[model samples]
Target: MREKLGKISNFLVSLAAGIASFVFTLVAVLVVTDFNEKLAASLIMGLFALLIVWVASEQPNSSQARAVSALIKRLLAVGSGDLTSPTPAAVRREMPALAAAVDNLFEQVRSNLDNVHAIALYDPVTSLPNRVHFKREADRVLKARGWDDGVALLFIDLDGFKEVNDSLGHAQGDQVLTMVANRLRIVVKAETREDSLAPPLLARLAGDEFTLLFPRVREPAEAERIAQSALVALCEPFEVGEQTIDMGASIGVALSPRHGTDLAALMKAADIAMYHAKESGRSQASMFHARMAAAFEEKVQTEKALREALGRSEFELAYQPQLDARSGVVVAGEALIRWNHPYDGLRLPDSFIGIAEESSLIVDIGDWVIDGVAATAARWHARGMAQRLTFNVSPKQIERADFFDRLRAAVERHQAPLRMLELEITETLVMKCGDRVIAELAALRAEGLSIAIDDFGSGYSNLARLKDMPLDRVKLDRSLTADVDRSEGALAIVTAVIHLIHGVGCEVVGEGVERREQLDLLRAVGCDVVQGFAFSEALAETEFLDWVRDNAPLRLLPRSA
Candidate 1:
């Protein structure tokens, strides 16, 4: 188009020059003939110059207009289709600078558009396909697969993620999520290579929620293996900034055309499976089964029943005496919690404590236990049956912002002597958050309450840690007592543990002492206290009161001399 305009402009200038030359020749001839004729020639030359300017500006050939129309059509085609057209040589030469600039602009626009599209389809944070793109790809893959073949959708939800955010802050939480995403990517990539079929697609659905679509999975086991790998990957500690956080994930997997034939169904099934994974225990993976759905429905009913039970105050405490091994005297009684669900009857910790822990009902439940046990102990103290009352403390409860304040209030409310209260914490709990546990224990001990380590040697049993921690006593794990008859190693370990704990000026209590030999070995090993079926099981509140009254001086060996 510009080339045509240039040609017309040149022709106009040439024509004007020819006309001016002719007029100049005439003026020269007139000048020679008569000097007065020069003015007329000048007037004619000016008229030709004006005509040249007008014609040069006009599109006389209509070629420039036609070329412009063609150029616009080409540009529209490039916009609609692939933009691979080359600029014409004529256009380039006629408008060299403008043509070059336009070409560069088009290329830049194309590059930017590509980037925008890529980001829209994939998350920049994880580099995984976003939900929008994953759904599209999953549908395509499922539709193409034969009925005999199967696809699996694994939904992964991280456990305790909120704790990471709460304790470490959101920046560290994001770092952990990024690390999880990277691990998932590696696992999915590996699976894709193994199958050699339609490779699986992994995506981040939202915060701490990710999805993996395995195409053409050979069998249910393939999906199971993938889920297991994901669980293992997530179980490893995440190194975030200066701290290492133990972040774990639960995965639920559902197979297409089996669990669900459509996206919504598949998603629902996967969600249900994920819930099961969390309910069964965090840091595990579960596959969708018909029974799991049934169990989930039952769990929903159980949760409702539990909440109702709580409102009705149907929960109670059972006391088991912690006997001084040498004298057989009940120096303290450990408070064992029981849920007297109206419908479910008496329930033990094994049945419901897990549910409480997962739902964070442990804090409320733990408080109830503390208050009820403290009140019972206070009553006993008023009746001249005063003995230390021990209650278990969950890690979740200890980590609460108001743990110490709430505990202090509970003791004051019950008017229970702080010296007669003992808090039993598991070794695993202590090791999980050592500094926090130590500080909390020190505070509680300073308040005149005793602290005992429960299930000692069940976790990182560092002797130095035990010596440094603010603990008054340690409870030997039941495993050690159970194996005392079968393994000399077990007996030696118990003996060493007792000596070590005593060396640190802390008392040792033996748990699960069911047989005479076990009790004898524990006493011989210098255990200060013993509690198990060997004496009696946990008793009802009234039965415990009577037993405490009747068994006044509980003697272990009847003062053998």
Candidate 2:
């Protein structure tokens, strides 16, 4: 207490002495000058006022106060992005507690900044750069490369990822994604290091999409080699939990100056090329070309048109007769979708169905078809028509958890023609469907909705899986019967398939029986039903009903007549 009082007393005395000296000096200066009497008086008064204000407001009373003032000035440097400035030693020595607190505050700020940066620029799940970070780095690399050097961008998309998610669940899907990112990093790192090239920038763009930037590659072959390595790395199965998942990637390569020198253009080209690789059969790489952009634009336009198609009511259904092999009576009419495009005239499903599925428009389109077919069946049943009506189902439609509910509602809304409605799905879909989907199909079947396998022999013929499904009929693919009348091998295979299907307690329907010989062959092989041009091409609703009424006893006769 005495020491503090003595210090304060001494400070006051010194301050008084300093003030007295400043006054004396100013008076001495005015006397020495003896010039400009009014100016000298004004200067003395101003000097005295400044001294008083300095002592009262600005001057620090002790070393601790001075240190704190200096420390605050230094800390405020943070506003200018100068977080790394060191604290003065004198300040540290004078007030260690405040110095330590400031240091801790700076540390917390830095840690928080790092976290924000990671969240902004890195994918949390894979810890790879996110889309924003990828684009920033890619732009930097492209700019640094200039016109002399060439760079390549690889846009990679995973194949069969949706199936993995649908069948195994999203948790397993995330595991697969993380493993994929790690494998890609390893492969890319290894290749770049082995070749002693500049390290490539890799990032997860979004779900199942990743990007790799090669900053120093000039040759397409080099990029191709890297893409192949990445593909081969992904070819190794990812073992997640009890499941060993086999996944593949399609990589698209776009070179700077060739595709485009900018980030947006390069990315667009690479994305288009990647889709081409995927469409041309996955597990490969495709280089960007001008033609791909055109096709991509066309597809974009088509997708846009398709989106408005349902709202515009531009879609309609045509029915083709499915006949009993012995009677040739129209047992069912396969409902096929037609787009009465205003500008393009009548368009087949082939013109837009692929786009519809890719853009997820199939779900809505599928719903529309279901409603249309149900209404048609109800109308036909009201008119005393006994034949069933069938329509194809898309995999995307079945992927929905509420597919059964929606379908049942549609049927009931149309007075419940569950007995006259048959749903056809591809054989591959039937085989690949998850247990939940299979159960739903069984539930629908139990509700008296017949399930038929469409294009049965088109893909992997897993008859065992087929038997496990609650299916009532299997329709042979057109390919299977394309030459069944001429080729003994085809006939034998068809006969075996029919018998196998029959063995599973499912009736066999032969598709594309356009010739009498084919019909005769199918019938001889014990095929229960046939449908093709041999009966009639798909007809409009009214035409179909008229044909059905006129040819109710339509006999199994050759089209040659």
Candidate 3:
């Protein structure tokens, strides 16, 4: 009784002492404080005495202490990610409020982690798994794949998406993207329902680039069918807020265990195929092959070398002169670029022009050509060897927003007379370019730059449209003039084209006139200018200048004019 009640007796004594101390504190604080301060102090002292008694009674082995220890262990376990472990009832009953707070905190942390993961792994706009997640899923599928399992990846790039974004605002572009995503989802989901195959994994790899993975397909054709379905779905024009937009997709397909066994290889193959499809004209699909990757790698190497070539000044112009059929003299010269490659000897325009055009290196390349041609032609003008210098202009350069501005700047910088510089565009470019492009060309023509439709019969010929275009010359493609002497039908076609071009007040030029009979036919058909291997091939600058000196009275137009 003495030992047990001793704790209570000590607590009573401590309570008495605390009361006296509280009174002293109130007296001291009352001097500088209010009645509320004294009342709070007395109550705090009483609670302190009871806390001491409770602390003394609850030893390390007491139920309260045991409950606290159990709670600590549970908290440590929770911190260690053992959320499934049960919370002890002793801890909860002893400290219900604290237990409740800990449980809520645990859930909150878990929720935050999940939300962070979702944000990191998902595209918010399309609500599709991102590239990282897609690659992870691909790896998982590949690992679990059976011996005969074939997985296919389709890399889909939206054709003309940049155009839409440029013409319409970004808001409109976003709407278009969301709609496209929805269409893809619907098409893939619908196909999955019909076939008992596992659902296709769709992901938005990046802006305007989406990917579809068939992880459990038995054959590559199944992947292609899904691509077809998606393309068909996109074929229908999308409507956004009273405006209808036309969009197309280019797809590249790669099969697993054939094209590649991993995500990187498969994506690479598909990417190459997709790029090829885009180049071959959009709204198409292509399959990945080993050769495709090899070709792509080669192209990349070539592009890099081309950039170095530009920097090293390894390029030069080879001139091929045009002759007057009546006078039998060289009249004007066409400036053709040649790359004097260090190891590959001389590289022709055909070897690299397509690559340049595709990569938009043409813009820089065209600038280089313009500067070089303008400077060279300026020198020729000073030497009385002046003739209208014709140089091919890429279609992309014509469409560039800064083309005219840059052209005018280059001409001024080189002090080359615009009248002496002739820009030749392919018929394919002129026919497809917007009216705005024609308007730009007219502005260039206004500056006295002559425009010729090069390779006139190559395609996209609208005779009526040609009349409206500002033109000074029409170069009939070599195909129309190749067998002019061998076939009367060819001569008739050439004669008709010449007559039609003459009617449009444009001079007619025949290309690829190698045979004397071809020249005779061209003269008979009233063709004004002829260029081919018959008279002279494209020559180096020195060779051309010497040839110009050798052939006197070959000037087509006066330099001052």
Candidate 4:
């Protein structure tokens, strides 16, 4: 009886201790943990209860009792976060199902933790290390190296990615981004040194932007070589699904100690250099320089001013006369935009147009131009001037879904005749816009507006497709006409181009004519219209009207005489 009582007392004591532990762990887990953790806690409590029952039913020194005791000790260790503790083989043999369940629970918890860690550190779309991880890893490597050797950082930004997303769906865009990340990884991996203390690191900073870090770079030439490799890798066409997409990357290279010493500084330098690469042209790399920073500052200020210019009514138009080559008579004028900036004096399109185009501010500016030109054309028509006026169009303006409606509204609002106005589109824009643009242009033509291909011969265009366009005329770029008077080669090209335009039922306008020899050669080649400084430079609204009246004598003279 004494022995039985002692065994019973010892079992009660063990059961009480196990119950207290279960209660404490259960309270904590229920209060602060997730469903999985609560479930784990409940299973542990059940295990302890089973052990208590086993101890009460078994002999004082049985194998069951020993296994229960060992499992209780292991469970205690596990509850305190020591996952390395394992259920004894005796416990597994005695309670195979329960021991397997516990082991599976622990394995699942570990796998869940790994998944959470990856979600926090990597980009979900491309599976590349994100900005947070990139910064952390870059800082660690930079500190470990002690700044003994130079490091090169490249900031990569994709060009024309937005257009891809706009044309194709976001799903396709994600595929492009994934392919881009994989290619970048391959390029960096190929350049990685096998024995270097710090290998190259690559990360996706954000949408359409990535970074590459090269450690232990000894020369700028080495950095340049890697940058070129990256450019070439990205320049190749990416095949996504059934469609082939052409892409390009602009890279900015920044060297340690020269451009910056820390991650933030290096990022800023590399970013600025990348902007320079984009400005020079995409699909290239640019090195960090102090002047680039200054230029970037200027560009920012100019963009801000341009955005505000429309609101301030600081914009005006100047017209350069286009005369009939056969009659030597002023027949039309091309409208050019000018900004009368308050702080910078007068600024031409070359000084700020590219900046406007980049920010998409040109859309608003183009609207303003269209309204202003329509109003002016109305006034001209009211005064009996039937001569047509041409205005350049931007790709952004054409891309808007409501472009046609907005244009027609502007003309209707000004009560202007469509025949008195013409639209000029560049050759490159025409090619890029494809069939939709052709259909739109035909619709616009049906509405009585004339369409002209501007800057001809300056860009690539399929001659076979030229006949399909709704064009009234084709303007010869100054590049082709500048040397026509001096070079037979240039003159021959011009003559052939004129005949081609004629074949397509379109007249040819030779621009930038600054000399009699050039004019005579153009006239001899069957050019229809001429415009440049030789006749008149771009003039203000009032100056143009005055010059027109002043040059009435030259209007009737035949150039063929």
By lDDT, the best candidate is 4
Which candidate order results from sorting by lDDT in descending order?
A: 4, 2, 3, 1
Better of 3 and 4 by TM-score: 4
Per-residue accuracy of model 3 over 1-561 as CA lDDT, tens digit each: 434565576567667766766676666565636688777766876776677566555534345566788988887886677875666787787778877887787788778988899988998887889988988887887777787878888899998787678667799898898898899889767766444245668899999999988766657677788888888887689888888888889999988888888888888899999998887888988988777778899889889889999999998998998987777677788999999888899999988888998887888888888888899878888887657889998878878888888888888888888888899999977766777878888888998889999998877688887889999999999999999999989899999999999999999889988987888888888899989988789998889989878876544322220
Q: Where does candidate 4 clash, by residue pair?
A: none
Candidate 4 C-alpha error for residue 189, in Å: 1.9
Candidate 2 — which residues are off by over 4 angstroms?
1-61, 87-91, 193-198, 556-561
Q: Rank order by TM-score, top first?
A: 2, 4, 3, 1
- In model 3, the Cα lDDT at residue 276 comes to 86
Q: What C-alpha lDDT, on a 0 to 100 scale, does residue 7 get in candidate 4? A: 72
Q: Which 10-residue window in model 2 sums to the lowest lDDT? A: 190-199
Give a tens-digit lDDT track for model 1, residues 451-502: 9989987767777777778889999889878978668999998898889899
| Cα-based RMSD of candidate 3 | 7.9
Q: What is the C-alpha lDDT profile of model 2 across 394-476, one tens digit per residue?
A: 98898789898898898889895688889999887887888898888888889788999999888888888877999999999
- TM-score on alpha carbons, each prediction: 0.71, 0.87, 0.73, 0.79
Choose the strongest candidate by TM-score. Answer: 2
Q: What is the number of residue pairs that collide in model 1?
A: 5
Clashing pairs in 1: 327-555, 328-554, 328-555, 328-556, 329-554
lDDT of each: 0.82, 0.87, 0.83, 0.88
